[model samples]
Target: MQYKLPVSVLVVIYTLDFEVLLLERADHPGSWQSVTGSQDEGESLRETAVREVFEETGLDANHYGLVDWQVQNIYEIYAKWQHRYAPGTRHNTEHVFGLELPCVLPVQLSPREHLSYKWLPWQEAAGLVFSPSNREAILQLPAREKARG
Candidate 1:
């Protein structure tokens, strides 16, 4: 079995107006989040972000504003998902990114990875994400946008 790399990317896809796109997990229904995935060997974090966004939402990230937030979070892998990494690998490092779209657009989710998708106000989206890191990223959207501008 191929074990996943211990590095990943978390991409918060949102609009200039603060509407965020979230995907409901297929494996764990009701758990909604932005585009996220583990990095493959030889892939940079930015590449991981773009690939994950495409895989999860069918959005061409390059056509929009994809920014690496220059933030990293090291966290314990969820107990149920630890097996996806090498044996005894309990932690993963996740790089943060943001994909700024002009507006909310329909998404085609990878059925195996996500069950559904939605566009919600940043606050509501932040409140609904299952991961604290994801929530924090969404919460920072306003400040991040201001800084970008």
Candidate 2:
């Protein structure tokens, strides 16, 4: 069946030192964000996160520190992006995750989905992302890390 659930995962790819990785959206050149994608049928949120990270950035989620913040955000779908979903879909559920690597690692971007990638400090990454929820997730990283510690 064509999966129509607006559920998805957002992985904030960062380093142990808090350098976050952001990717430019191919469809919207200046728009940048962490690894994100819709979930497929029968896939758990964590599984979706791992698959999307590899699909979008070639990073093995298992090799790094992959943590599910256990945070979920439900937001109204942007008018411009609503076309990608089924008709009358007004909202989406996003599960937030954090993938911490040792350092800025090489990326293999899906050219059709992203134009480029950048590694930046947490503050800068938070500011650069277009989505408010994504920015909020980035901003929460430090506190999340600290709490985990």
Residue-level lDDT tens digits of model 2 in 53-104:
9999988898878988889999998888787788888999999998989888
Please give the distance, in angstroms, between residue 85's alpha carbon in candidate 2 and its true position after superposition.
1.6
Give the residue spans of candidate 1 off by over 4 A: none
lDDT tens digits by residue: candidate 1, 38-79:
999999888889899998889899999999999999999999
TM-score computed on alpha carbons, candidate 2: 0.95
Off by over 4 Å in 2: 1-4
The most accurate candidate by TM-score is 1
| Alpha carbon lDDT of each predicted model | 0.93, 0.92
Residue pairs whose backbone atoms clash in candidate 2:
none
Report backbone clashes per prediction: 0, 0
> Which RMSD values do the candidates have, in order?
0.6, 1.3
